[model samples]
Target: MNRRGFMKLMGSGAGLAAGSAIMGSTLVQNAMAAAPRRGGTIKLAWVDAVDTLDPHFTASLGSVKILNNIFNGLLKVAYDGKKVSFVPDLAETWEMPDDKTHVFTLRRGVKFHNGDPCDAAAVKWSLDRVKDPAVSSPHAWKFETLAGIDIVDESTIRMRFSKPYAFLPVALTGSTGRAGTIVSKRAVEQHGKAFGRNPVGTGPFKFAGWRENESITLERNPDYFEPGLPYLDGVKILLIKEPTAAVAAMMSGQVYGMSLSPFQFIPQLKANKNLKVYGEVEGNYSFVGMNNRRAPFDDPMMRKAVAAAIDRNTIVKQGYFGEAIPAYSCISPPMTGFYDKNIGNSGRGQRFDLKKAMEYRKQSKYQGEVNPVYIVAQGFTGSGGSGTRNSQLLLPMLEKIGIKPKIELLDRAVWTKRRNGGDFDMYDEAWIADLDPDETIYPEWHSGKPWNFVGYSNKEFDKLLSEAQDTLNQATRKKLYD
Candidate 1:
C-alpha cells in the first residue's frame, strides 16, 4: 500500500492510550448544568481492563486513573497536562518547615466513605502502610526518601524526608501512580487482602461495586469534604476492551464519556457536532520493552538492530497522525527545561536505517536465524479486522531488519501477568501520568527496581541517575543525566 493508504489504515486502528482524550455528547449536556446540575449519572468507558482498585498494589495505568477519581492525596498535580504543579487536596494547608520536613494541617470533618474519620492519624497510617514491606506496595519506591511521619495533633501531621528531595511534593500528588494517596486505616485493616475490591477513600466518589470484566460502579460521596461537589449522582465506567466497539458505543450515545479513544477515531469524533473532545499531550511514553534476559534480544547488536530499524518521525506523523511529538528522550517535549532538542539526530541517538539494522543483525548471535518473537499488545488485535494501529507502524519496519513478529493482542490482565512474570518477549505498552525524569526511567530501567520489567541493569547508568536525583542544581543534574 502507498504511505497515504497505510496511514489511513493506521489512523482507524488507534488503540489504548491512558488519559488520551475525553469525549462527551448528550451525556455532558445539561440545561441546568449552568446552575450546577446535581443528580445526573455521568457514564464513561475505559478501553483497558481493570483488575484492582487498591491504589498501592496494581501498577495498571487504567486502575490508577480510576483510583484517582475515587481517592484523594495530600496534594494533586495540575489537572491540565501542560505542566507539573502541585495543589492541595486532602490537606487543607501545608508548609515545608525545612528542606527535609513537610508539615500539613488536615481538613477537619473529612471522612472516608465508610464514615470513618480521615484524620491526621489516617494519613500517617496510610503512608506507613505503603512503606511497610508486608503490604508489598508496588509504589513503595516512590517514597524511599521518607524518613518518618510525626502526628502533631488530631488534625496535624509532619512528614520528614531523609534528604533534600525536590520531587517529594510531586510524588505526593493525588494523581495516578503517586505515593501520597491516603486510604482509610480502618477500612484497610477491616478488609485486609480484600481491600482492593472494597476501596474506601475521602474523595468525590465511592466504590459501589465491580462486575469483573464488565464494569465498575461508583456513587457520589454524599458527605464529601468538598461542598456541593462531584456535580453528579454517580459515575459508571464500562470496561470495553475493543477500540472500534468503544467508538461505536460513544457515537451511539450508549456511553456519555470515553477515555483512551482510538486515535484513528479522532477525526471522525471531531466531525460529529454534538460531541466535545478534550485532549492534551499525554504525560506518558509508550514503548516495546524487550525481555533482555532472553536470547536474540540478549545480544546488544540485535537490540540495536530493533531500535535502528523504525522511523520515529513517520510513526508520529503517519501512525499518530500528528497527534504526538516524536520523543527521543524519555522526558517529553512539554517538560521544557529538561527536554533536549539536539538528541534526535545521526550523531547522537538511533536514526532510522534498514541497512544499519541489517548490518547489526548480521553481527548478532542469531545471525538471521532467530525465531519469530511474539510482540504482545494489550487490549487489541493486529490483523483480525480489529486492534491497535501500532502494528501498522512497527511490523514492516522490523521485517526490513529480518525480525518478523507474531503479534498477540492479549487481555490487559493476561498481558500484564506475562510481562511481570518474564513469560513474554516484547510488550507494547506505555507508562502514563509520570512527571519527574527520575521517576520515569529509574524505576523501569534501574537495577532490580520494582518496575524494571525488562531486567536491564547497568552500574554506570545507575550511578549517573542516582547522582542526578541527589544533585540539587538543575544544570548539574542535566550534566549528570547527559
Candidate 2:
C-alpha cells in the first residue's frame, strides 16, 4: 500500500469522533493551553490488574496500556483529527530501500529504565526476542513477515521482510503493536522468568512496583529522551474491579482518571460538574464465534443460521446501552477500507430473521442442542461487556428458532484456554484492530492460524488475503479486500 492507502486504511471516522470527545474535554483543553508542567502525581484507576509488565507476553488491553507508558517502539501511530499518521519514536528516521527492506536510523541518547543503551543491537534483540520460540511471546505472530534484523551500525538497523509488506512501520506502532517495542536486553537476561515483574524499557515512565490486585506504580524517567515529558512526576494505577466502587472513588476525588469507563456510568459521570469524561470509538468489535471444527457449526448452514438469529440491534441497545455500533463483518467500522458496510444492514445481508434462521437450521444434520460459552475478560462492564450480554441475548433467540443452546460463563483464563484448545461449540470473541487491516483479518480467519480458534477455513478467502498482502498497489489491495 502507498502512503495515501496507508492513511485511508488507518483513518476511521468513529475513531476520530472518539478522540475528539476525549481531547475536547474541559480538563484536556485546559491542559493544552498551559505550558508543560512536570511534578504532579496522577492517580489512574483500572478495572483490571495487569498480570505482567512485559509487553511481549501481554495480550490484554489493560496490560498493554500500562506497558505503553513504560516502553518505546520503533514507530508510533498518532491521530491528527481524522487522519492517522505514523511518527518517529525510538527510530528517528527510516528509509525503504525496496518493498521488502526497511532501514531505520535509531535515535541516539535513549536509555532503557535499567540504564542499558537503546542502540541498534537493543532493537534487534527486542525484535528477535519476540520471534524466539523459547520466549513464546503472544505477539510473535505480528512479526511473521519479518525475515531478519541486521544491525548496520550502533545507531542504525535494517529489517528484511519475506514479501512486500506495506504496513510494517504501522505494525511497529507502540500503542497497538508490541512487537516493535524495544526492551532492555540486559534486564531480560538478568531477570529471566522474573523479567516481566521487573520490566525495563525506554519510555516516559519507569516501573517502580506492582502490588498484584492492589496497584502498579511508575516514577518519572529522569533520563527520558523527550525533554520534560509525561507532565506528571509519577503514575499510580489503582486496580478497582467494580464499576460502582470505581465511580465512587472518582466522585470522591480518590482517582484522577479511569482507563476503561463503564458505558452505563457515562451519563452519571457527565452529570458530575467537577468531572470530565474522555472517550474515543476504539478500533475493536465483539462477535459470536462458532466452532467450525465440530459438528453443527462445521456446516455452513448452521453458521449462517446462528449469524442470522443474532439480534445485533438489541445487543447494542441492551448490552452496550447504544454505545457500540452493530458489527456486520469481521472487521470493525473503525477499520475503514476492510469493513463491508452492506454485510449487516437489513435486506443487504445478515440480520435478525428467525424464519430464515430456522430454514437454515433445518438443513443441518446435527439438530441437537448447542452449548455456547461466554468468556468474560478483565474490566468487563457495560461498555466492554458485549461478550457476556450478547451471549445472554443469543440464548432465547436460539431457542425461539427451535435450536436448543446453553450459555456458560467462564473466567477469562479458562475461557481463553478452552477457546484456543477448541473445547467449545460456540463462544464470544472480540478483537482490537491493529494499525493495519491484515492484523485483524489474517490471523483470525486464516486457516490453521493459532488465533483462528473458531477453526474457520476458506481457501478462497485465504488466497484473497495473501494476494492483498503481496500486492503493492493500494487500489488493487482495496479491491481484493472488498
Candidate 3:
C-alpha cells in the first residue's frame, strides 16, 4: 500500500479504538459531566526524572512536560481532538507589520511567581538569555534568524528577523516548540545555576518543592492571569523509572495517571474496569540512525543497500508490537504540508529487496574488513527494549548482505552523550517533532546545526530548506520540500 493510505488506515483504526475505550468507561463519562473539581492534588508518574526545570536547558520529554505547567510563552499551541492551532498566551494580541517583523501586545497585570512584571523588557530578557553563549541552550538554533528585539513600549515588543520566518510564532508556542518561554529576569539572576530547581513563571502552576530523584511538586498559581482556572489545587509528579512499578502505582491508586505505559501492559490495563487506556498515533518514529560521517555509510550506495536489506514490517512488529507505522520520509506523517508521501513510492529506497541489497553491496568500494557497526540503546523506558529487539532482528538481515553489527545498551546520560557526539556507527533512536515542519526538518538536516549528528549534508537540500523557510506560499514550500 502507499504510505499515505497505510497511515490513514492506522490512524483511523487507532482513533476508533480510543473512542470506543473512552465511551465504554463510565467513570470517564461521569467525570466529564461534573463541575471542575478544586483543591485536590493529582499524582502523575514518569519514567525519567526531570534534569532541569529551565525550559532553555530542557532536553528530555519529562522536563518539557513539567515545564509546560510552570511556564507561559508569548504564544501557545492548542491541540484539540482533531487539529492544532496557535493561540495567545502571555501576549493578548500580536500583529505582523511586515514579512520580517512581528509585534506583540503584552497582557497587562501578569506577574511572575517572584512578583516581577511580565512586560516587553521581560520578553526581551527571556529571549536574550536563550541566545546567550554562556547559557549554551540546546534550542539556540531556533533563533538563528533572529536579528533583534525592539521594545516599542512597556506593553509592546517587536521581534525582527533577518528574513521571513513563517514558523517563528509557531515555534514560540510551547515548551515543546522553541525556547520562547518567558522567565523572570530577577528570579533567574538571583538563582543563577539554581534557577532550574527554583523555577518562577506566569503559568497555572508554581514550583513548590523538588526532592532529587523522588518527586517534584507544583501548587496552583493563585494569581494566574486566567481567573477561576487551574481547577486542581496542585500536582505531584513522581519519578518512577520502572514500567512494572508505574503500573503497580496506577493499580494501587498511588498515581492518578502515567505519562507513558509499556505497550506490553496495555492489554492488562485495558481489561481493568477501573482504569482507562488512551491511545493516539504520535507524530514520532523509531529508526536505526546511520552515521554518514563514517565509512560505508558515507556512500549513498551503501546507505541505500542497508535501507533495502532491512524489513520495516519486522521492525514494527518486533520492536513496536504494531504500535508504530513504517516511516518513509524523515518527517513524520501527522505534520501536514511537510511530509513527502511520494518518497515512499520510490522503488529504490525503503523497499526491502534482497536482490537490490546484494547488487548495491557489490557496487560499493569498501570491500575490506568492515568493523561491526555499533548500535547504542538506552537502558530506561520502552525504547530500550525496542532498540534491543530491533538490533537482534536487524543482525541476520545485515549478515545476508555482508555487514555485521553490535548492540550496546547504556544509561540515558551516556547514550545521549554518545549520540549527540556522533560516537556510534549506528544508534536506535526516535525524534519527537515539534508542531511545525520547519522545526522538525531544519535542525536535523541543516549542515552546521548541532543536532545533525549523522553529518549528512547536501547543497541542494540546504537550499530547498532555506527557501521553504523564507517563502510564505505553502505551495511553493511544498514544492521545494518535495
Against the unseen true structure, what C-alpha lDDT does each candidate score? Answer: 0.68, 0.69, 0.71
Q: Model 1, range 221-305, lDDT digits (tens) per residue?
A: 8999787788888989888877788778888888887766666677887777767676656545555666778776777677777
Regions of candidate 3 where Cα sits further than 4 Å from its true position: 1-35, 80-82, 340-349, 382-385
- Output the number of the lDDT-best candidate: 3
lDDT of 3 by residue, 1-482 (tens): 22233223222211000000000011110112246667888888776446789888775666887888999999997777555667889999989889999999999999998888998999999998887878888788888889999999999999999999867866687586748999889989999989999999999999999998788999999999998979999999888877788788877777878776665566677677777776666655555667878776776666666766777766766666666656654455556556554645654225567898788788888774455566555545534235566677888888888888767877878888888888888777655545666776677657777677778676655666677788877676655555
Clashing pairs in 3: none
Better of 1 and 3 by lDDT: 3
Q: Is candidate 1 or candidate 2 better by TM-score?
A: 2
* Model 1 error, position 115 (Å): 1.5
What's the residue-level lDDT of 325 in candidate 1?
Answer: 53
- The clash numbers for all candidates, in the given order, read 1, 2, 0
lDDT string for model 2 (1-482, tens) is 43233223212110000010101011110112236666888887786446688888765667878888999899987776554667889999989899889899999989888887999998998899998878887678777788999999999999999998856665687646777778899999999989889999989999999887788999999999997687889999898777678778887788888776666677777778777776655655666666777765777777777766777777767766666666554445555545555654434334567787788778877676655443444435423544566666767877876666666677667777887788877766656545567776676767766577877776666666677777777677766655
Candidate structures ordered by lDDT, highest first: 3, 2, 1
Model 2 segments more than 4 A misplaced? 1-36, 337-350, 368-383
lDDT of 3 at 210: 93
